[model samples]
Target: MVSPLTVVKSEGPKLVPFFKATCVYFVLWLPSSNPTWFSALIKCLPIFCLCLFLLAHGLGFLQTHPSATRIFVGLIFSAVGDAFLIWQDQGYFVHGLLMFAVTHMFYASAFGMKPLDLRKGLVIAVLSGSSYALLYPCLSGAFTYLVGVYVAIISFMGWRALAGLQLIGAAWRWTKLAAGSGALLFILSDMTIALNKFCFPVPHSRAIIMSTYYAAQMLITLSAVESREPVEAYGLSKTN
Candidate 1:
């Protein structure tokens, strides 16, 4: 029988080319401010691959925890959001936002199953509230209300992720941290999107926003895998 360790070692090298291809496609897609169908398809390939990667890892972790399935579902929603947003000119912005809102819900549900620190959750809530206060003046009408709702949900997701950082297992520590950081970055990326779309035009905002968004998704996916590792191997217990 093939050892899990050996399988991991063998599979590790395959990711290098996948990552390289994603980078190449992203770079090519970046030059066209408004890309043609072919260019848009190329741009979407990286996100599609990233979603596949997340799904694969999430499925692999399913034996360890049912929460892993939530991660997979979240990634699927994220991929749909990516597809919608890629064609923003076709009136898909609202659709993309709704998809992502659902994505955050799944992610939040997954993280919420873990132990949380109430104090940290409170701190994150305050921060998110402050951010919304700053952005509210720039928005108006129905868009304002929609954005506000999105902010609230995504903020709650981030808070749950941050609270997970205090979880007491060593094997889960890095995973929790990565997931928390990813949640924060996801908020940052969405905030940037709101600012660029409603408040002001940020220079090179597409590159900045997509880079953070991709990194956030990747990190969250990695955390799902990391979260499945055995705590005993790291000489730690689940209790604080």
Candidate 2:
């Protein structure tokens, strides 16, 4: 895909709300042991803001770049996942995992599987497969297949992102970098979660997970805005 360098940056003001919501979660919610049920709203605020940001950026992309639209929908699913996760100790882990699995499917669909380089896909698959193996002993019988399936989907998502990152002409473009980095960071975030819950406790796991997760989402959101168009491109009319 082309870089579409003309619209490389998203509107900075639109990100303020997302950052503010993240700060509130990290500062007030993450540290609180007695967080109220209503705090689930705070947990989802950043994702909600991101969905609004994508909509506010514009909808014209849906005509030519359905990928951006898919990511927007993915973010909405992520928000639901976040809500379910807050109650994980109450048996919502599986529900939350299901939502996030759907989120990865949307992201993988948005990333596309074109230029399917076996080398790249294989590398990602090996990494994800090894990770699942590492966690195999800790996984409960009920969730063994579920977690395995989730890992496979996310690994495929990363493979698709990696393939796009090496677009013949736009190898070094910000769109590629953003999407690729976002996918990697997303993998790291989920891996951290698995280690914390299934394998062993990670130091400050919640903070690390949230920080990387939000940053990954932010980068992915920016990529959608950059890859899609604005009102026009040079002398070429997008409406054409």
lDDT of 1 at 218: 65
Model 2 misplaced stretches (Cα beyond 4 Å): 1-10, 30-35, 62-64, 167-170, 228-240
Off by over 4 Å in 1: 1-14, 30-37, 54-60, 166-172, 227-240
- Could you report the Cα RMSD, in angstroms, for every candidate shown? 6.4, 4.2
The count of residue-pair clashes in candidate 1 stands at: 0
Question: Model 1 compared with the native: what TM-score?
Answer: 0.80
lDDT of 1 by residue, 104-164 (tens): 9998987864566677777877887887788898988877789889988998889877776
Candidate 1: C-alpha lDDT: 0.73
Q: TM-score per candidate, in order?
A: 0.80, 0.87
Q: How do the residues 1-240 of candidate 2 rate in per-residue lDDT, one tens digit apiece?
A: 443544434367788899999998878755335545678888888999988888786676554567788898899899889888888887888898999889889988877777678899889988998999998999988889999999998898888877867535535666667788999999999999999999899998988898899999988887776553333432445452
**Residue pairs of candidate 2 with colliding backbone atoms:** none
- Give Cα distance to truth, residue 64, candidate 2, Å: 4.9
Candidate with top lDDT is 2
